[model samples]
Structures are given as structure tokens and as C-alpha cells.
Target: MSQISRGLENVFIKTTALTYIDGDNGILRYGGFDIDDLVEHTSFEEVIHLMLYGDLPTKVQLQRLKTSLNEAYEIPQQVIDTIYSLPRESDAIGMMETAFSALSSIYGEMWNKNTNKETAIKLIAKASTVTANVLRAKEGKKPVIPESSDSFARSFLSASFARTPTNDEVKAMDAALILYADHEVPASTTAALVTSSTLSDMYSCVVAALAALKGPLHGGAAEEAFKQFLEIGEPERTEEWFKKKILEEKSRLMGFGHRVYKTYDPRAKIFKRYAQKLSERSNEARKYFEIALKVEELGIEKFAEKHIYPNTDFFSGVVFYSLGFPVYMFTSLFALSRTLGWTAHVIEYVEDQHRLIRPRALYIGPLKREVIPIELRG
Candidate 1:
């Protein structure tokens, strides 16, 4: 039986160039390129094209895709007003969910079952717009629509702040996006696939994915890791804090441990470098860098023997924090990158409609017995 049919096993369905797992050696690959290679040598937009179209784009092809995304990066005024008027404390994930729900009302006809490939392309291109706009609105700023000629990574970063980004900021964000662009089918991606299997619209599928990614164990970790640093108070005290934290029932250091990666997370190594560069570029508080380095060192030195290593979330926290992104928006940006992978998987599923992903469950309760009347049962 296939892993999808078994349900409990990690289901790593194959693709021509995608890699799903290295359960024994702990590696991740996409399109035959190791994650480490892609992050250093490729842009996030290029990676998205690679996954979706199944090969790296030529310079001309990549430029065209960037242009399409840039054109699609504007939100309607009504959507912006709705987002800005929400209460300040509204959960970011909830904001995304509500935003998507509202979008469904506006684009009802474009997301129909019979919608053509052109409509699908627009949805894929515009996802970054809806996402970046929400983050800016929550901060009481107007969103910047992307300029058609702007680079994909720069447009996303700039749109969130409604301003053009500096060269350094764009470079850092580009690398961050590439690093996060995909990871096999995680639990949240599975949630998206399951939702899409029901023939839900693209907005709903992406919203379901955002909800799943918002939990502490998933996309929520990057922000939580920084929160932990704040609570630690001093860089020198981190090890002691960890000692105390490990004993507390309420504590688990987010971003330090990953379900995958018995060794270092391939993407983390690339992001770690960018985090350092970003720290210097922004002239960040030294404590953040100090704490991050200590955490990474300690994570490996103390926990490597036990198979715990820092994931992409740890260093990404520093990179994003230094870039002035609110911690709550960490997963939203993650959603931005991972959206490409989600669409790719959805397209693959639509192509391979061999099964609806139905799986069996083990019944562990009492054996079947005769039913009784309500009074007798009580």
C-alpha cells in the first residue's frame, strides 16, 4: 500500500526532480538541487518557477514571471479598508483567513471549478499581494502595489512596507525567500492537499494552510524563538535559561528542534549567514546576535548527540526581526514563500487524480454492542 493509504507513515510521493525525505541521513532536495545549493545560487522566484514548471527558468522566462507577479500585486481598496479597520489584537492568522474569505466574495467567478489556467495563474501571482498587504495594514500603513518591472523578492519586501527597499534588504529577503520556498509535504501542506481534494477554491485551500501553519509546532516557531530571547534578558544567561526552561512544563524552545534534520537543517546554514549580514546592515542590538549565535552553538553542541538541530526558523527569526517585520507576521511571510510549493502540489494532485487520499483508521475502543434505549444507556 502507498504511504498515503497507510496514513501513519510519512508519505513522500515522488516527482521528476523533487525529493521528499532522507529519514535516515536527514537531507532535503528540490528539483535535484540540494536546498543548500539553491538558496545560495537562486532567487526565490526562480525556485518557484523551478518547482511549478519543473526546471530552472531562463533569464527571459524568469523576467516574464516576475513581471506577471508584479502586475498582480495590487489589492483592491475595499480589501485594504476591511483589513485596516480590524481590531489591533486580532490574530494574524485569523486576519489572513478573513481576508481570504472576503477575497472569495470579490473574485467569485475567477475561482470556479471550470476556471481556466489564466485564472489559476492570476491567483498564484496575486497571493503575495494579499499576504504582504495584510501585514502592512495591521501596522497601520498603506500597502504598496508592486511595480511591474521590480524584482519579485524586492516587490514583496517593498510592498509590505509600501516603499522601495534598499539593496541590502532586498538581498537578505531574497535569500530568506529561497531558503523557505519549500520543504517536502509537511503537515500543513498535507492540509492544503486534503482541502484541495475536496475541490475547494484556491483562497480556501491557502487559508486552511495558513491556519495549520500558525500553530506553535509549525510556522509559529520563528516568532516564538525571539520571544524566548526576550524572556532570557541577557545573552550570557541563555544557557542557564535553557537549563531552567527545559525543566518547566510550559517551556519548549521553539525553532531549536525540528521533526526532520537529525543533522543541521540545510537551509539553516544559508539563512544563518544572511542573519549575520542583516544584523550588521541594520546595526541591530548586539544582544540579538549574541543570543542567536549562542543558541545555534548550544543547539548543536549540547543537542547534536541527541539528534536535535536548529531548523530554518531559528535564523529566519533574526533575519526577519532585523528587517523590522512584526513577529506575528513571521508565518505570513512563510506563507508567502510556501504558497508556490502549495500550488505546485495542487497542480500535481489535479494531474494525478488516481485516488482521493482516503485512508483507514484503527478502532481502539470497545467492541460493537447492541444499542439500548436512552434511559437504559444512562
Candidate 2:
């Protein structure tokens, strides 16, 4: 029998031209455009347009996309109604899961309709609204509506915090969203594609993907990594804390490595910059950023020889925290950013002559035998 690639590591199931990652060189591309190029030149909405369409938009097209996003920013009435019924302190993730699952009724008979531009737009725009609102509700605040077509990054932050974000904060948020927009074929995107292969509604497909992202081994890493910094308590204490946990305690540090990239995560490089800038946003932010930097330097010095370097989650938690999101809401931000990728892949898989994404599993068990009588003697 052939070898089983446990967890399908290094396995190729389908071909996608959506996004590309060269782990060895630490490169990422979305729709064949270099990620860094997109970050420098494009807005988050522009990046979404690039992912949904095959090219950058003209002025008219970009404006239409922005207008559509502004229009779609409103959460459907039913989803909001459901949110209002939940306890103010309810889980942000659960709120998102339940709210998205309610989409089948919003579009009514979505399984028959393959993913299109509107489907993509609604998910991308509403994800920001829904994620921000859930956090607001948890904070015992009213849901803030997004009003502008131009600056979603600013809109989301202002709405969620009930205060306008400074220019630096908006730029940081935009960069963070762009950095996280997509990553070729991740576990969650694959799960979404698998669901889409069955011709399931986009709602069900995205929810399945979100469930995969919720795993602590995946999307939950950022939240845990942030908490680790808090636990370490102070920047000067980072080395001692790391030693106590890694040497004496023999524990796993949350944010230092990734499965795909041996080199430092490219996103981490960008986020670390934002984290540094955001650290200056407030005194508390500065302290956390210092701790994050200390942990990174110590971790790389210790583990880089083994190709275990900082991954995206390493600084993402600090960046998000500096932006005023709660630790628990970290993954919600991840999910919102990643839904663009998921929505894109769903469209590509459904349109590209996809197949059911099941693979054969090896079974190692005793051969079938006849059942013994009720009381078989030993």
C-alpha cells in the first residue's frame, strides 16, 4: 500500500490560480500579484476586487465596488435581530457562526446559484460589519453602522469602538486586513471548497470553513499568542518567562512557528511594523509590543536554527490588541479578513470543474470475525 500523508501534508488535491505561496522563500501572492505590491498600492476593497475579478479595477469599476460595499455593509435585519437576542457577553465566534448560517434564508435557495460577484461582495462587506458588531454587543454597546464607501478599515474600527480611529490606526487596520486577505490554500479554504464541491449553499460552505478556522491549531493561535504576552507580564521579564515555560515547564510557545513556512512569515514582518507603530498608540500598547519583540528575538535566537521562526500570529495579537480589539475577538478579525479568501476559493472551486474532496484513509484494525456469544469465555 502507498504511504498515507497524515493530515495531507504537502498534498495537492486541486489546482487553483487564486493565490500562491512559496514557503521556502517566504513569498505570498494573491491572484498572481505580489502581496507586498498589493499592500503598498491597493486598498482592502481593491484587493477584494482583485481576488474576485482577475485584474485591478478601473476607476469606474473601483468606485462601483466601493459603493456596493457601502450598500452591503448593513447586516441583514434578521441577523441583527438574532444578535440582539444573544447575551451581550456571548462569544463573538458563535455570533458569527450563527449569523452566517442564517444567510440561507437571506438569499433563499442559494445552492442552485453558484457563487457570483454579489455573493462575494456581501460576504466580504458584511463580515466586517458582523465581526465588529459582535464585539460591540459583547462590550454592551450599540452596533455602529458603517456609512462611507471609501474606507472600510476606518469604518469597521470606528463602529466597533464607537470612536473614530486616528489616521495611523486606520492605516494599521488597512494594512492588517490586506496582509491577511488570503494565503493560497489553507485548511479552512480547502474545507470550504470541499463543501462547495457538493453544491452546498455558499452560507454552509463558508460556515464549514469558519469552523475549521476556529480550531486552536489554526485561527485560535493569535488569541492564545496574545494572552501569552500578557502572561509574561513585562518586557524585561520575557526571557525569564520564556525560560521558565520552555526549559523547566517544557511548554510550547504559541506564536513562533508555522507548518508551511520555514522562514519568518512574510505577514509577520508587516504586522510587526504595525505592532510597533500601534504600540505607540497608547502606553499599554507599547508595553505589550515590547514584550512581543522580546519574545520574538529570544525565540529566533533559540529556534531559528531549527527553521522555527515567528509566524503571522506572533505579532497579529499585539497589533489587534493595540487596535482595541479584545483578546477573545482576535480570531473574529482573522475570520473576517480570511472570509475574502474563502469566498474567492468557493467561487473558483465551483466554477473550475471541482470534485468531492474526500481522500482514502488507511485502517489498521483486526480482521472481521464472527461475533461471539453474549458471554464468551476468556
Model 2 misplacement above 4 A:
111-115, 373-378
Estimate, for each residue in 1-378, the C-alpha lDDT of model 1 and write its tens digit: 232344345445434344455744767778888777776688777787788777889999888777667667666777767777788677787787677677757763433434423344566556677777678777766665656645677777777776778888888888877777677777677787777777666666677787888888888888888788777778899888877785444376578766667777777777788888777754453568778888677667767787888888888888888888888888877877777776667666655552466556656688888889899986
Report the lDDT tens digits of candidate 2 across residue range 47-145: 888888878888899999888888888777778778767987777788888888886557534543344767888777888888887887788888666
What's model 2's overall lDDT? 0.83
Candidate 1 local Cα displacement, residue 137, angstroms: 1.9
Q: Estimate each model's TM-score.
A: 0.89, 0.94
- Evaluate residue 79 in candidate 1 and report its C-alpha lDDT on the 0 to 100 scale: 73
Q: Give candidate 1's TM-score.
A: 0.89
Residue 319 accuracy (lDDT) in model 1: 87
The TM-score, computed over Cα atoms with residue i paired to residue i, of candidate 2 is 0.94
Q: Which stretches of candidate 1 lie over 4 Å from their true place?
A: 1-7, 13-16, 19-26, 105-121, 247-250, 282-285, 369-378
In every candidate, how many clashes are there?
0, 0
Top TM-score hit? 2
